[model samples]
Target: MPTRKIRRTQLLALAVAALTVPATAALAAPVPADAAAAPTAPLAAPATTASTTTAPATAVAASPTGFLNLPTSLLPTDRAPHEISFQYRNDSAGDQSIAPQVLIESPVGGPFLVPTAVSLQVETSDGSWLPLPLGIETGTLYTNLIPAKLVLHSHHTLTEHYRLTVLSPSLGTVAPRIAFYG
Candidate 1:
């Protein structure tokens, strides 16, 4: 397979390019109160008016986690495999949940012609990698939802490493996009 590994910068660029979220519905991580304090020299305190009401602090909007990480390049059909790692974090003040799925896009502008066999494995808590129960067989675009849900607590991060094997010679060289929703 004619494949090349994508650098971290390139992977991030590709992820940003491929994923699109609307402005209104986007969620941002709240800034810590201490970090929001501005540094100022000795200044006279302004007189507080009894009738004035303090405006509530506004929270800055941002994405707590980034796009799901997958290898930009897969190993050749005969090679053992390659390991890739990514971190998912919850920067929001509250817990966040997500379910992951695989999205395969047509390589050519035309319809997909062959079924791609993909094998995926996820790392376990014991520092061991285990194969996930996922199977895909199709010629057109499709999504294979992984049977797992991850809940990240505030200011916490979950690190994961995974290996992907694509059996379809035509698709082995193509990178698959991992999507997280809900």
Candidate 2:
């Protein structure tokens, strides 16, 4: 009985998430060439020296610069969470590192989303999915920052998986975005 209830809840959540996707929705902007060269703060680095800056973390992260907004899409109306895959391609000659972010559209002023699990996997020549080594860094769709652990090789594409739920009562749409920074 407990297992059945869990499955029902997962199905309900996925159904709710999929309702937000438009029937003819199109993907967002493509990644630019210079996007791979964009510089970002180290994913795992501690402060060497203390106490010069007193600004808040949000203030410091205000509108990241030199970043490219990768393609974005909401949950498709016809597919379940597991059946859906977000793809990103690396057209450059060298490998490029990428990070994932999400944007939530809500009727309320502020909304919350819980990301249960996220994973990045690359596609093999034989059309198999292989998991990539993920980093310890964590981020949410609202934070617009997924750690840069997975790298896409030259002319290769990678797929990402996201399991998310909107904690708030108000319905909100979740769209995933990718950012390139190598």
Candidate 3:
């Protein structure tokens, strides 16, 4: 009976010690500062002012004068009736109009003809250029994708020279070339 009582006391003491050990350790540890503080409000951003000076031009210069001067006989003679497309970005401020021209030259003994349809568009900074018919919105950056489709008869060949002429009132003229197999 005495031994049983001693065992019970020992078990109770061990359980109590185990329970208290974690509590004591937790009490002794330091609490992090952030844990005690209340949730903070987001900081306000500073206001911005417009600049008077104009931004530098970012359009890449075209090679070989006005034409996107490509190698001689770039398109295969066998590949007749081809289409050429170009993609570019214009981030100039203020309002501007751009006229793009797609030119295709005939290969040796090949037919030379003007493109059928040419597309020039300016996208707003928000990536919505088409749905809005107002043209490029003011103060926002834009991407202009201009595609010129040319139909050349079997006798007419593709020209190695192709150029995209960007006539902007604000940025002047920017001509970028195109080089494609077909």
Candidate 4:
């Protein structure tokens, strides 16, 4: 019941640390075209030309919606008989981006799901849909209670989270409750 720190960057780091993405894959969000021209800017690509397979980073957001309003409860879990509810929230704002996170609780040694993938929708207030940069955070948890692979076997309660994000505030209100995997 202690208050958990909600620093999205650190929290996202924790989430990223848990994931198992191959080291060779590109993990950096694309640099904006304007920023790419500046040699002093970090992530300033040597070349702005995107590969045929990839869209330019600027193209990722069209007509550029000003910015997102922070912290919306997009998904609600049915905790049922359990006392704690699973909750999802947008943890990013302004130039900072952290994938939205879902806080989870499962009984130790019990069969449970750690989501491998999930899906969501985003739409404008006017009802037009927008493309979402979607990803499911996956990683291992390391500690005494959690083993090397992050599997649970102890008697203590486990509360952890993973990252998921919807790009636009236009995120739709109607969707099935988010589900998980083992």
Per-model C-alpha lDDT, please?
0.38, 0.38, 0.24, 0.25
- Overall local distance difference test of candidate 3: 0.24
TM-score between model 4 and native: 0.20
Question: Over the full model, what C-alpha lDDT does candidate 4 score relative to the true structure?
Answer: 0.25
- Which portions of model 3 show Cα errors greater than 4 Å? 1-73, 80-83, 107-182
**TM-score of every model versus the real structure:** 0.45, 0.39, 0.21, 0.20
Q: Is 1 or 4 the stronger prediction by lDDT?
A: 1
Q: Kindly list the per-residue Cα lDDT of model 2 for residues 1-182, writing each as its tens digit.
A: 01110011232233334334443111212223355345353322211223476887433222222343444445332323232346565555555555554444343444333333333333333445543222121122242232222445566665555443322334444455555443
Q: In model 4, which residue pairs have backbone atoms overlapping below 3 Å?
A: 18-139, 18-140, 19-138, 19-139, 123-170
TM-score of 1: 0.45
Q: What is the lDDT of residue 23 in candidate 3?
A: 34
Put down candidate 3 lDDT per residue, 98-123, tens digits, no spaces.
Answer: 22232223322433222222222323
Q: In candidate 1, what are the lDDT values of residues 1-182, reduced to their tens digit?
A: 22222212232233233233333122221112232132121111111123255545443222222234344453345535556566554455554554333333344453352433555555555556565433233333222222233444555665556666555534433333222332
Top-down TM-score ranking: 1, 2, 3, 4
Which residue pairs in candidate 2 have backbone atoms (N, alpha carbon, C) closer than 3 angstroms, thus clashing? none
- Number of the predicted model whose TM-score against the real structure is largest: 1
Candidate 2 global TM-score: 0.39
> Candidates 2 and 4: which is better by TM-score?
2
Error of 3 at 50 (Å): 19
Instruction: Please give the TM-score that candidate 3 achieves against the real structure.
Output: 0.21
Better of 1 and 3 by lDDT: 1
